[model samples]
Target: MPHEGEATPRISKVQDRGWAWVVLVATVLVQALTLGFPSCVGVFFKDLQYDFRASNSETSWFPSIMTAVLHAGGCESILVERFGCRVTVMLGGLLSGVGMVASAFSKSISQLYITAGFITGLGSCFSFQAGVTVLGYYFIRRRALANALASTGVSIGLTLWPLISQYLLDEMGWRNTFLIFGGVMLNCCVCGAVMRPVPDKPPGPTLKSCPEQSREGACLSNGSTSCHEEPLHPSKRAACFQTLQKYLAFDIFCKNKGYQIYTIGVSWMVIGFVLPLIYLVPYATLNGVEEHKAALLISIIGFINIFMRPMAGLLSGLSIFTGRRIYLFSMAAMLSGLSNLICAISSEYSVLVFYCIVYSVSMSVIGALIFQVLMDVVEMDRFSSALGLFTILESITILIGPPLAGLLVDLLGHYRYVFYASSFFMISAALFMGLSFCTMEAKNKLKETNKPPPETPSKGKYTEVPTELDHDRNGPPTVVYVTSI
Candidate 1:
């Protein structure tokens, strides 16, 4: 029994199935609604450009800002902690819907930037962070598989949204399409609703001062208390600053070496990671493929990815990839780089199809393992902070990568150079991560070799034993002695 004021330690309830799988489904929907729409922005590229009379580089800012905000939005973890995943995601849904609805009324590119880029992007960040963070709350052993399964929402959205968006653009025009997309985005509220909050560990018994009872005699009301207990109100300014610090998670970079290495590698990789995706349709059309056919290529990538992501997740979770998921991620990055090189050289439709297949495989493998690797390196309690820092760092590349790729396209009067640049950056990122992995392995090996040997049960003693048993009529068994120093 606990003492008068003592509390029982609450074990976290980690359910691998039941409500956990439901959370996975909700997370998948949230991801589809939040991430899927941005990926299909490629289908809107031409319309956006023509309507606003913007150059490729200028128009690229829409997706760039959106992507940047999506990543930078990881800071929504503070909201998740304060408001809970359900409310945060609901707020995100409302903002995204409102942004899209407002975007339909925009007469200029700048308005689109505010409505589509900043508002929708901010909403996406909230839903994404909440969905991902809540996912980690539900499963431990099966987290990789769950993440993979949830990630398929992106592929599904990518596969379907392009077709839908293209059709909508043809019939309704960009303005009406934005209006409808806003409605579709509102479904995220449903997703948020389904995200039943996973119960956190209950707080220990806390003593509150009682005027009648002495401090020593103060009694705990219950064996457990609410973890959500509010502190006595503090100064408003101090509270505001504390909230900002909690949300920003700025200290993670200073404290975690492995996380820092991973973040840097991811940041570098993002500089080119999605460049091909952004430019694929344009590149294909430049090569004389029909617009519809080029759009189909994205669907192809999505279709292949749907299967590939789950497979990668399941395989990585197996014992074979234990302690070496980062190596798998590195290999995937290298393969993606090679795929980009293939895309750079290939103009034929069939060859581009092959490139899509290869790219899909690489993308799926990397996506499935990336978060798993991060989670493996960071403690569960710190995942939100680490992820927030990672997103903010990666957002720098996301914001600039597309515009720079577009600039290359404009300068060269071709798309091949952009692909080449992407390939180079991706390969560079792979090499950097590979080098980091090798260094980590070497350090681990050195530690192993330098580890002190186990103490012997009998210190400084030598023991003798028979090497073999000899059964003979006239001879006793012979013995052999072994000594340890």
Candidate 2:
């Protein structure tokens, strides 16, 4: 007899159709709700400043903490592994709702730091990671398209959130607006409701599969009752270590050069990537642009990205971009840096508006390809762990990006310098990643050409987990890659 959820096979055969579409839609909504809020923080920046009598650095802490906490990759990986994505997402939604509702009553920025920044951010972290993880599991043939589509939620969230925040602030002030945000955040639970788990590999005969483990009392005890819950201190430590190994990509960090380069490059890029989102509206407003128009600058980014991001995704899905997508992503980051530099030239209303459009064009590609590139670096089974580590590293940069910019503003007393700093970081990071990846590709190609052919033919199927990618019906054979336990 089959074990629970094992009667059916891995969803690969059934992926990209039927219930996968439902999961996709839910994932999109979840992504929008979580990722979109960070950028929207700009719309409320002034009111927060005026009401709390806080400095730019103090205000920066709120979003820095929120966005940082939201990328809790390590924590999220453990949660997704233990309880699965569904429970983790609903739990995040509930916590996020509480955070927002509590923020509405906060008497000080410090309290908002706890409630709005940490709690809500932690909630979003759970929802975003789990949603993205499930979406990956559900599609392979259309993986790029699905990711591109899901990523649009970020743009959608970006577009609608600012307008919503501004309108709500106008009608009922920030407190009531936050109260409403709490309600909006709760919808994550509804999205989580539909993310059914994909089936895992069917169980093998217990004794036949693991004689050594049984002998060591790992899965059995004295040929009687199981001893899964009770173990000695050392055994517990060993078990914990194994779980970390299996569920976290600590090993990948050390072994995979591609993963290491990707993680580091992305992490470094984030420091510059996040500054403009937090500071753009304030910079525009400070330079004498009207409040509503300043907000519109950000909205323009979302609007342009709505179109550009999908196109980027579709382009990535093609065979031509099979191995070249990373270069495209790098170019986008470089373009973003160039656009930030342009902002330093002038803060005129029309000039800032032009800057928004150009920045949006670059970021659309970045947003679509960022996580998708990570997916390319690591196989699916290891993706959760890889992403966990990736996010944790990037979150550090994100947590500090705004505050560092705020410090620059505080010290130099000019917003233009933030753009300069942003440009420096982005340009340098793009160059580093682009060059590093290009070198790796060239080395791999040279190695392939120099290697000799096999001396003898052998026939054996791969024992490790294999992902059956249905790229084409009559094209080449299925491409197989090893999946870690």
RMSD of each: 13.3, 6.8
What overall lDDT goes with each candidate model?
A: 0.72, 0.77
lDDT of 1 by residue, 1-485 (tens): 24322322221332466777887888888877887777778878878888999888888888888878977854465576556778888889999999999999999888898999999999988887677666655555565456667788888877887778777878988899999999998888888887765443222245242232223322211111123335588898988777655545556566655666777898988888888778888788877998788888888988888898778877877777776777888889999998999988878999999999999999888887776677666554555556556667788888999999878877888889988998988899988987886786676556557986455311111111111222211111111110000
Q: Give the CA lDDT, 0 to 100, for residue 454 in model 1.
A: 50
Q: Pick the candidate with the highest lDDT.
A: 2
TM-score for each model: 0.81, 0.83
Q: Write the per-residue lDDT of candidate 2 for residues 1-485, one digit (tens) a residue.
A: 54424434434445678888998899889878998888889888878988999888888999999998987666775676557778888898998999999999999999999999999999998898778777656666776567667777888888888888878888999999999999999999999888866653332447344433334322210111122233335677798887677556788888777778888898999899988988998899899998888888888988888899878776766778776777888999999999998899999998998999999989888877786676676665676567667777888888889988888988999889999999998999899888988887776666557986345311111011223455543111122111100
Best by TM-score: 2
lDDT of 1 at 420: 95
Tell me the lDDT of candidate 1: 0.72
